[model samples]
Each structure stands twice: as C-alpha cells, then as structure tokens.
Target: MDTDIFSLRGRNIVVTGAAEGLGRTFALAFARRGAFVACVDIDPAVEETCALIEKNGGKALPLMADVSNEAAVTTMAAQLEASADTLHVLVNNAGIAIPPGRLLDVSVANWDRVIATNLRSVFLCSKALLPMLLRSKDASIINLSSFLALVGLYPGFEITAIPYASSKAGVDGFTRQLAIEYARDGLRVNAIAPGWHGGTRLGRERQASSEPAVIKRFNDFIQGSIPMGHMGTPDDLTGLAVYLASSASRYVTGQTFAHDGGLTAA
Candidate 1:
C-alpha cells in the first residue's frame, strides 16, 4: 500500500498546548512526517518541544500565549502570520480540567475557566488561523475532545469535573458547525475524543487534588471500565492525529473519532 497519502511533507501545522502531554506528542509526530510545526502554549516549556523537534531534524517554531485570552491569541496569530505564508493543519489541544466534585459545589470561577480554556480557545485559535488555513489546498483543524463529552460517569465513579465534560461537548458542536460552514472553502474540521489516557497533566492534576480514597476509586474505574482493560498513553493517539491531519483523511470532516481502548464501545 502506498503511504504517500499520509505524508505531511512541506505542510505547515500549529499545535496548541504543546508544552507537554498530548500536544507535545502531536507536534513531534507531525515534524517527523515532514511538517513544519508551530508549538504554541502559555508555558515556557513550549520551547522544549521545539528543541526536541529541531534535535530530530524537524522544523518547529515555539509561540507562547494564553489561548483562552483573545488578545493573546490575536498576538499569536500575528506572530504565526509573519512566519509562514500558509497553514495546513491546526491542532487545538490546549485544555484543562478542574478536580472532580459535586456539581453544587462547583464554583462559577472554575466553570468559566474550563469553558474558556477548552471551548473558547478552539474558537479563538480557529478563527484567528482560518485565513492562513484557507490559503492551503488541504487544510484541516483537529480539536481535542473527551469521552466525558458523550457520556456521563456513573454515580460514585465521577473522576472528571462537570465543567470539563460541558466544555468538550461544546467542542464537538463547534467542530461540526465550523465544518459545515467551511466545506465550500475546502476546509476539514474534526475532533479526537480520547478516553482515560494516562500520562497527561490533566490526569496528574486530578490525582494530586483528590483524596487517597477518591484516587483509589478512580483507578478501579479505569481498570474495570475499559473493555481493553487498560488506560491509553498519549502515543496511542498519534497515528489517528496524523491521519486526520494528512491527505489520507481528505474526505473526512465534521466527525469525532474515539481512541478509547473500547471503553466507549463497551
């Protein structure tokens, strides 16, 4: 089988939240396939991602900005526009999750923060980059969603905050709406809904904030819930990400693909 269809040679891609976790993995993977990646994040560690890509003989640019802030995203767009003439792919991977707790106990501040980071950033970055993306013959936007967006946790099995789920659900809606609006422009919009992925800062944050008993229960849920009987690593999503970002999925859009180890299937 010819693999050239999956090649991203000479493509210009931007990945937000690329300082670590899934974002870093996506940035490196795209660079390996010959794409010039712009690694964007509010964290200074974003430079480390660029260094890794450069060390591997791949081209990368690091940009720091608060994706949830309009002014910051605008400035990031300006920086990117000045550097590249066109954008082939954009990965809206910046997101955060507050600690799990009763909905009644959730604060308005936390709710707004999750919505801004997870949902609003998708809108901000996509809107800011649309002009550049439109310049590409094959443009795609990949949004990071979650299994929680599609299904709610069982009672006593809640490991994620309600705001996290709500924000991801909003992303799914945004992906579909934006795809339809831009189909005539030859732009593809899609989302990746991952389930129980370990080694991510989001998971680590939850673990650090929860009590020992809560952590034990969450672990039990992970062990017993997924049909494949294991949590996934960030590397597990790289292939699907590349597929969505490449010509291989040229005909695919407005869809959310799950990489859940059969957790969603079960």
Candidate 2:
C-alpha cells in the first residue's frame, strides 16, 4: 500500500569495492534514492565515491579496508556501526579475476587468493555485519556473482577461469544457504550474476596481456555470442541492485538474477 516500498529512503547501505566500476555506480545509485551509503574499499579511490555522493546531496562514508581480511572486515563493520545504528543493505561486490590459465599450471596459492577475495570476503562481510542488518525492519544482502558461476564460459575460457568460476559458484551456494537461514528474520539474500560489461574491467586486467588485435577479435566473438548482440553497461545493473535492496524485493530470496544481456540465456 505504501509507495515507498520501492524507495531506499533513510536506509543504511554498505557497498564493498566501492572505489570504481560497478561498485561505485551502485553506491551512487543507492544514495540518490536516499540510502546513506558506506563506501568501503582497500583503495583510496573510494574517497571519490564518497565525494560524488555528498556532491549529489546524499549521505556517504568512505571506509578503507580489505574485505578479504577477517580483522579488516570486522573493523569496517564496527566503524560503520559506530555511526549508523542499523544497516539495511549490503552489496558484496569486491572481487578479482586472475589471468586465465589451466589448473595444471595454477598454483595453490593463486587459487587461495582468488577464492579469498571472490568468496571469503562475502562470508566475512556478511558475518561481521549481520547483527546490524538484523536490527533493521528490512534488510538485504546482495552478492556479486558472475555468469561464469551459472555455466562454464563456453570452453577455452574455462581453462583460465576455474579459480574465478569456482569462487563465484561458491557465492551462489552461500547466498542460498544464508537467505534460507535468515529469511525468517526479515533478511533477504540474493546474488547478481552479471555478464561482461563494456567499461567495467569485467576482467580487462587479464585481457590487457593480450594484443589489441586479439582483444578486438575476442570482443567481437563475445558480443556475437550474446543474444542481445551487444555488450552491457555498468548502469544496466543499477536498476536491479536498487530493486533487490529496497522493499520491492522483500518477497524474493535465494535467487540469482543474471544481468548479462542474455548471454546466460543463450
């Protein structure tokens, strides 16, 4: 009956990896809708995110911490809680993709690094902030997974992506389990499985090792593979993120909404 169900007014929201790319976009989006955002990241660039929010007349806090580290995550939660009484939304979007390589050559340490950042950070952030989330009338946890989590990336892509894929798939599992566990407490957990976006470095750090020609050709192949016949933009996800975080999705839980321009669908 209340039109505000779709609005995030007066909410306290945390967004990990809020330095740049999709995370920054999400923080700005939430803040624009009246959510007080905590922009957390290991990089100082998160200060830019906070500044942008404040410039737009929205509330924001810039928190610097490594989401993968238990102590750092705990401190981030404590610091955020010291100022905000209750946390209403958490967007776990911090992640990395190691260079593509077969498992035969992938070291155990490399695997741990990927898993720790992509998966463990989700667990640590959620664990540390759940108490604050529990105190809210409506709370939401949105995990950032990938289309690779739903399916192996065609074929060759899988060789260099096992570690990343494994980590994201683990996120899907964690989301479902946690959602079920806390659904009764008015907490909803869900995942956003994004397809490749044009400007977000979606994994461009690894792609940078390739020749420009190779990159262009690879991009053509990827775009052709997507049912939409084009790449996605970072803003494409903001609507979905807002929906899930607001009371609009209160009845939704344990679901992974893919925003891949129909790549996973095809």
State the C-alpha lDDT per candidate.
Answer: 0.93, 0.90
Tens-digit per-residue lDDT, 1-266, candidate 1: 44699899989999999999999999999999999999999999999999999999999999999999999999999999999989999999999988777698699999999999999999999999999999996899999999988888865655667899999999999999999999989799999999989888887777778889888877888899899888999999999999999999999999998889898788
Tell me the tens digit of each residue's lDDT in model 2 across 207-252.
7777787677668777678898887888999999999999889899
Best by TM-score: 1
Deviation (Å) of 213 in candidate 2: 2.6
Best by lDDT: 1
Clashes of 1: 0
Q: How close is candidate 2 to the true structure, as a TM-score?
A: 0.96
